[model samples]
Target: MTLEENAREHPYEPVPGDVVRDAATRRVGRVMDRMGLRVQLRPLNGGREWDAMPQDLSPASQSDAMSAAVAEANAQSWRGR
Candidate 1:
């Protein structure tokens, strides 16, 4: 099978630093690590990490990523007050 075919057979897996969404929780986070079939995700604003099943993860949309970043900035500003 061609590389493209192989890739199609295997779903895309996120690497560390990749922003993704957890469909199960409808939350956006960065991929920290992967253990077996579970993927570790940490919030864009920084917080506790959680393990999510690979099947439940999808690449975050541009809008979603921007929203997360804005939320983090807002949180930082609030804390500085």
Candidate 2:
């Protein structure tokens, strides 16, 4: 998908603990900057930084479906209380 489409689809505003992937290398990282979507990831070890902006990030359909299932399970657990 296009960058705009990806940006609009992501759930959060891109903050710390949010998962993002670098478009350049397709490596996943955790967002460290909310405003800029700057992500910190370490492929080797040192924790390099990568930006997700201007880059497309289409969440894998399988992962999205899995997330929805997990969310539903959590909701069901909460309702069982």
Candidate 3:
């Protein structure tokens, strides 16, 4: 079978809390929920959520996740000042 056929048969499905990158937006977010074929994602630092097709998402790299966490931490630290 062709790659397209195989992909259709077995699409990538990310569960809630999984970090992923949206190919369409080139943004990293955590899976918030799924609605039919579309998946909801929220920024790591916490912001408005957006919906993206499963086909447009892939697992985020470890560095991406860490970078977001560090950025959030830095923001929080500044807020405490």
Displacement of residue 5 (Cα, Å) in model 2 is 7.6
TM-scores for every predicted model? 0.75, 0.37, 0.71
Could you tell me the C-alpha RMSD of candidate 3 in Å? 3.1
Candidate scoring better on TM-score of 2 and 3: 3
Cα lDDT listed for each candidate: 0.90, 0.50, 0.89
Q: Write the per-residue lDDT of candidate 1 for residues 28-51, one digit (tens) a residue.
A: 999999999899999998988999
> In every candidate, how many clashes are there?
0, 0, 0
lDDT of 3 at 24: 98
lDDT of 2 by residue, 1-81 (tens): 997687668643444654544567655554455344444433222244655563454333446445544665676678779
- State residue 6's C-alpha deviation in candidate 2, in Å: 9.7
Which segments of candidate 1 are over 4 A away from where they belong? 1-8, 79-81
TM-score of 2: 0.37
What is candidate 1's local distance difference test score? 0.90
